[model samples]
Target: MGGNGKHRWKISFHRPSSSSSSSKMEANHHNHHKQQEEPPKDFLCPIYGALMADPVVVSSGQTFERLSVQLCRNLGFSPKLDDGSIPDFSAIIPNKAIKSAILHWCDSSGVVHPRVPDPATVEKLVRALMAEEEVYPSPPPFSSPQLRVSERELIRGVAENPPVTFSHAATELGPRVNHFYSSSSEESVVITADNPGTPLPFATRPLCYSSSSSSEITESETLASSIPNSAPASEEEDHLVRNLKSVDVVDQEEGVLSLRKLTRTREELRVLLCTARVLLALKPLISSRYAVVQTNAIASLVNLSLEKPNKVTIVRSGFVPYLIDVLKSGSIEAQEHVAGAIFSLALEDDNKMAIGVLGALPPLMHALVRSESERTRHDSALALYHLTLVQSNRAKLVKLNAVPTLLALAQTGSSASRVLLVLCNLAACPEGRSAMLDGNAVECLVGMLRRNELDSEATRENCVAALFALSHGSMRFRGLAREARAVEVLREIEERGSERAREKAKRMLQMMRGRDDGEDEEGDWEKALRSGGAGGVGRNLHGPNSTTF
Candidate 1:
């Protein structure tokens, strides 16, 4: 009976058969396939259609692969995903939580972790998608009937009525005379020479013709002739348009030169000549291999962009990419004009964001630091100053490591005043503050203040303001300021500097002294700046003469 009991216990504790173990392994394999076949949808990027190695959230609040977002931004393409939604690539934030979730899912599901996609392969995919988009453009979204009718009417009105016209004689001159009206007067008087029976049309004369005995006229005839034997503005513009669209480089050069001359001083002509057809014709010449054509084309764009309305119109017409391209690779002369055009366009509040979005920051930064031309550096600095007024652009510049370059320039007094202005704007944002602190901006700025090396009271004031802006919630600033002996500089500014500088200096001193005033918090400082307090950078950027291009 005892032996039987032991046998029963042994049987109860025996190991499983080989077939049973094999069946358990098969079950696990099946579960692995099930998980691989249906991973979480959010783990995949809409643009890449694969697991995202590094996911980020864009301004549109959608997650995508960071490389994919960067490619779209650089190419200036906004992709439509399978869900028919378009992503805004203006701003990006890392989706750390989602990234963690994706990695965890991969580990648990026995799926291999995703790796960063190859840049060349990703670029090829993006270009192919862009080609498809070009071939088959997306349809417009639905709108109310009333809104649609209003839009149609607005477009038709713009199409039917040109911004400029010419006198009747000028219009009649047509292609016969290449001359154009030099005056804004609309009246055209045709005088019949002394005889009424055989009427003689007013003779058309070239702009540079000299008066001779045969051509001498009476006072009344001279007045009538002063009406100008010229072609309509539209006809002249069309002639330039044709030249710009010509295959020959000579014709293109002539067109761009004429455009530059015509739009240089006449505000009305600048507004009129900035039409879509004229811009389209002028676009290709901006990238021409011939130096004359490219320089004149960029200069013409600068002249045309002088008008207020033309600023936004030029950007909307797609001239920004060409301008940015010139900034990168054009001749030094052309780069100067390109910088001028960018500065002119950035003067408009509406254009600041678009210019930054279409990849203008990096090249502008390059021109600011590396260009040998003084005007190019000046305008490039001013353009950056204006561009960084927007928060998104400030963030982008910080990411580009602009603080160190700016600080270096400031230390050397190379465009120090303008460079400090950009720093002030950057200091308005949190990322800029952190970067500035990391770059030892406090010591650099304090050194300037201590030595009185800045250019003017305004520059000195801006340096103080930047320090004050950086002082918000920054413990590192206190220690750095102490080490740089900033307290003595602040004391001097508080005594003899401008009113704005004195005020900012006093506040920074208060913060450095470890005053527990409620105003020391970051939010309070931001609110104070936004509410037009002493250290406000964004709202006070546009000075009385700041818009000069």
Candidate 2:
């Protein structure tokens, strides 16, 4: 009986006939293919080319994987997709709906759920895409004839040892006179290189003039003679670089001052002077105890950073930490220049994270609140506004208890417009929203709106936008809005505010009235928010007239 039972079990596991086996194999192959099917196009990130685990909507109203957006922003490379459209990553908001749909689809379709990719792997992919975009078709062969011997010799000389100073370059170039004008209110002076002639485009703030007569000069003659008139531009640059690297305080001061003047107004010179040699030389001088050397060195960096390409270069050279150090303890004038440099450097997408990571937020906040110079405060506010656009910086600011300080500034109406812009960015994140609500931001913003205390239409728009961001899915927002009488203020805004502000106010009122019933209203709110929030303010704030040298 035991043998018969074992035989029966073995028979149950035996293979079928070949024909039957082939049919079963075919069925299983079809099922396997079905299981391996691709996901819907909407579920995939344009850059990642995979189902998105954490989707987010960017400033352009397009959804992408959050990691992909971060990588692109960090790389400062906006890629063009297959459809030939470039993404704008200026701001991003979580797309929970899309993320949910993706996960549900994966479950229903028997596809494995997606996971957040390794950051190292994602960065590699982003860099590969960047490399593709940077590749351009080679230019056609040059049609011009070969150069003469003197021209070649001149080019070789420049390549070997460039000009030492702008004045020296002007002297070597020819008889044309160079006029140096101060951008400040101080009286401008035209230093004639050879003869009085047409004015060059270069201009800068006034430098400290030597008080002694030419006949009385004695100690600085060796330094003065170093920059000869016959040197080319490359040689002149080298000479100034040597002075910057010199041990003597006077040489360092003169080099930085000359560099500051050289880069101030000449856009071409700013690009040329932003080399590694010059930046490295300017590094130590940034922290010099001599106020003149420190201020001028930082000011020169600010000038170099005005060039778009040099922004990232300056940050990568490790200037941010030193800038923060000076911002904390330097003189008021030096802090003004440091703030400006920080602001200018933060304009580049690549430098934003690095700057914030190198510990710029606390000192920047301090400058925004405590600096005596209005320019310092203004620049600090703008720097904060730009820096907080990145999510990491926003989180860091919230951790530093920056929301309350910022709200205090807004309530007191000191730089209210700029301060509100920073608040608007912070309100986009969950941590920031909780912090602001805890800090009674709804009351403060509502009060500002009720009293018409905001500085401009754009400022009021940003204020409404902040409240709008705060109202998203927060149980605390409704009660807070009621306590602040936000409905009346929003109604007034809906009736009289600018188009963007009116739309946002209407949405906020809907949420308060429990009429924000579906995704349609939410979608409209996203549209309104996307069109006018920090992105719009950024355009106006960084416009042509916004910044000056």
Evaluated with lDDT, which candidate comes out highest? 2
lDDT score at residue 53, model 1, on the 0-100 scale: 89
Which ranges in model 1 have alpha carbons more than 4 Å from their true place?
Answer: 1-232, 516-549
Clash number by candidate, in order: 0, 15
- Kindly state the number of residue pairs that clash in model 2: 15
Best by TM-score: 2
Mind giving the per-residue lDDT tens digits that candidate 2 earns over 165-241?
32211111012122322332222222234323312111121112101223432233333344344432787778888
Lowest-sum lDDT 10-residue window in model 2: 2-11
lDDT at 421, model 2: 76
Name the runs in model 2 displaced over 4 angstroms: 1-232, 517-530, 540-548
Error of 2 at 300 (Å): 0.7
* Tens-digit lDDT track of model 1 for 1-549: 111111111111112233434587788985585655565768777666667889986644467889988877666666555433345565667877779998898777656778898899777776777676652222234221112233334435545763233221111101222222222121112222432332111111111111123333334234323333343356666788888876656677767766765654345566667776687678767898777778778877877776777876677556777788889998887888898788878878878877887778999999989988766777788789878889879999999998999999887846776687788789888899999998989998899889888765546766776787888777798899999999999998899876667777888888888883644466665665444332223442322211111
Error of 2 at 132 (Å): 29
